[model samples]
Every structure is written in structure tokens, then in C-alpha cells.
Target: MAFTIPENLHPDLMPLAWLIGTWRGKGRGEYPNVPGFQFAQEVSFNHDGRAFLNYFSRSWIIDENDEIIRPAASEVGFWRVKENNVLEVLLAHNTGIAEGWVGVVKGAKIQLEMDQGYSSPSAKIVTAGSRLYGLVEGELFTSYDMAAQGQTLQAHLWSSLERQSEN
Candidate 1:
């Protein structure tokens, strides 16, 4: 396919144009005392002259042999630039999740606050939080500062996504 960028993309968003493609990769995640899991993630970013970048993501659990075993949740979102020099993103996951964020976008990093929609089936709503994202050593990474359970800060779901040529 030929590379043709949209004319309306704000100059601030031009830096992210390179990321407007399909990316497949593997990553690892851990939660509390539960064991970590290896998974394959695919992300797609697109633009259509709107103020935001359309986004879609899907993931699957992979075994030691790197074979997919089951399907994971899927997410759709949008990334945009706000007037106050802040970057905003709207995301929704098929697993009953959605969020809107406003933040700052550095050269290769993004720091934003996140409002988790409804991920777990337990309650209609949960907590809220803020997070920071940095492209470290050419890898995407993130950390969270969430407020919930009458307790504040805690680090959760931090991972680096190394580009995979294919699934």
C-alpha cells in the first residue's frame, strides 16, 4: 500500500503518523499473586480526517511454543490533540470497558489519566486513575497510579510491546 497521510492531521499529531499501521507482538503481564501470562497482541491505528486517530486492538493467550490458545478481549479507541496542548484519547473494549483521557504527548511518551469503564463483571463501575507512558529504549512501556479500594497508588499491567512482523 502507498503511504498517504491525511491533510487535516494537526502538526502535533504528525509525529504519531509512523504508528498508524497494524502491529502484532508478544508481551507478558502479571497481577498480584496470580502467575503472569504470555500473550500475543495486535493493534491497528487509522485516521480519517477527524481530529482523532481511530484505534483497534485484540489479544490472545500464547503457550510456551508461541501458539495461540484462546481469544482475549478487544478494544477500540481514538487519539486526538486538545487545544490546551494536551492529547486526548477515547477507548472502549468489547469486554465491557471504555475510557476518555487527556494528557501530554512528549517526543515518544504520553502521560494521561484513565477512567476504566466497566471491565470486570463484578460491579457496574470501579475506580479511576492516572498513568504515564514512555517509549523507553525503543519499546512502549506504561505505569499506573490508580485510586481505588480506599487505597491509592499501585502499579499494574506494565509491559513493553516489541513489534512483531506477523502473528
Candidate 2:
């Protein structure tokens, strides 16, 4: 599909224009000492003619037949594009963790490395993380690796989502 840049989007965000929409898909996740599970996710990246995009994602644990079991994880964040295609992301999770990530956009893919994080008194601390996002065959593919609970960084979640709307 041909993509026309949003007329009011800031110049610096041109590289991220393709992500300005809602995406929905299913993903599987597993972590040490945690049961593996299937999940359905919806992610949205929207903007208000500003220099950054507003991000939100919510996931629901699903049963074997793709039935919704319960709400799982939710996060809200912002994506900013800086000089030389550097990307900065700030995210706050429902689990009481907030993180800062820095990365660079290379064409249709982005790789982010966790720079720092803060955890609430009752939250688990994440010592490190990495996230990859790419436009693959018109679908958005995402993978996240994290280190927490005394475990080293490893694959945590991955999903492929199709564009649902242009919003």
C-alpha cells in the first residue's frame, strides 16, 4: 500500500510515519519461573502534529482457542525522533516500572537498548532490556528481551500485527 505522510507531522518524524496507526495481533510470552502463555495485543501510535508520537499498548492473556482469559499487561509511552535518526522512548508500565530507552532507526527497523529504569517498592526491577521493531512484509513485528528476577536478558515477548487503522 502506498503511504502518504501525514500532512501535519513534524519533519523529524517522517521516518516513523508508517507506524501511525493501530495494530492488532497475537503473541506468546515466557519468562523464568513463569508459565508460558498466549496473548492478544493491540498497539497504537498516534500523534497530534507534534514532534513525538504517543504510544499505548494493552494485552490480554488468551486461552488455547484464542479466547480472552484476562487482561495482562499495559503500557503507555512516547516516541521521539532526534538527530541522526536516534530514537528516544519513555515508557511506564502497569506493573509500576518506568524505563528509558535509546536507539536508532535504520530504514524500516528500530533497535532499542534500555538505558535506565525505576521500579516502585513493590515492583520487580529490570536490570536490562532490548526491543526490536520492524516493518516486515507490511506487518509490524516486535520482539522484546528483558532481564529481571535474577535472570539474564532473554526473549520475553514477540508479536506480528497488521495495521488496523490510519489513526
Candidate 3:
């Protein structure tokens, strides 16, 4: 596949230009308090000539048949890369969780950690979390580590999603 950068991307979002596409793949989720499960997800990063990239993701828990059993998790967010390579992400989850993450961006790699996060009384408490994302050889790789439910930071989710669409 020919990968070309979108010419209409905002200058501030150039660092995140590679992520301006749809990615889909399968992943596994594991928590010490819950049974391990498989899931499928699609994530999109889009821009409207704005300084930041708009992000959205949807995931579903899948059965052995690769059929969706139920919605697993979803979030909407914005990504921005500032001077000095500081990367910032703001996300809100359907489960009443909102978070701010900050880190560094180098080439097509990003590493972000929770700068602040808040959860509703009914939402599960996630004290901290971190994520690493990179585009290598045309494949998107991502992993998540989180601290929640009284558990310390540990690997929670990971996915190797291929670029499915550039729109």
C-alpha cells in the first residue's frame, strides 16, 4: 500500500499525521480481578485542518466465533504535539472517565502517561495509566498499562492494528 501524508493536515498536527487513518485488529485484555478475554477494535484519527487530531475508538468483546459478545470499551480524544516534542492527549470514556496524558513524540513513536484523570463515583477507579504507540513498517502497534481496582501498574491491553483506511 502506498502511504502518503495528507497534504491538508494542520502544521501543528504534522507530527501526528501518520496516525490519520482507521486501524482495526484483535487484542486481548487481562486483569488480575477478571477473566482474560479477547476483543476486536477500530480506532480512527482524523483532522479537520485543525491544530489537533480527533480520535475515536470502539471495541467489542468477542467470542470464539469472532462474533461480538458486547461492547467492551470506547473513548473519544484529541491529540496534539507541541514544541519540544511534547505530546498531549485528552480522552473521555463512555464509562465516565476523563483523562489527560502527556509525554514525548519521536518520529512515529509516542509514549504517554497519565498527567491527570478523573472518574465518576460509579466508574471504576483508574489511578494511573500509560500507553505506547508506534508505526513501524506500515503496522500500528500499541500497548496499554494501567493501575486500577487496587492493582499496581501492569499490562492491560495491546493490539497490532493495520491501517485499513486513510479517510
Model 3 lDDT-worst window of ten: 1-10
- Candidate with top lDDT is 2
Q: Looking at model 2, which ten-residue stretch has the lowest summed lDDT?
A: 1-10
Deviation in Å, model 2, residue 164 alpha carbon: 0.2
Candidate of highest TM-score: 2
lDDT of 3: 0.91
lDDT of 1 by residue, 1-167 (tens): 22345567656567565456666667675545548787787777777766678878788988999899999757798888766558888877675656777787766677888744455665234367676756666554645565544554455455455543311
Each candidate's lDDT (Cα)? 0.65, 0.95, 0.91
Across 49-86, the per-residue lDDT of candidate 2 in tens digits comes to 98999999999999999999999999999999999999
TM-score of candidate 1 on Cα atoms, chains taken together:
0.74
Question: Candidate 1 regions off by >4 Å?
Answer: 1-12, 115-124, 130-133, 136-139, 142-153, 162-167
lDDT of 3 by residue, 1-167 (tens): 44567888888877787888899988888989789999999999998887888999999999988899999899999998899889999999999999999999898999999999999999999999999999968888889999998999999999888899896
Candidate 2 local distance difference test against the native:
0.95
Better of 2 and 3 by lDDT: 2
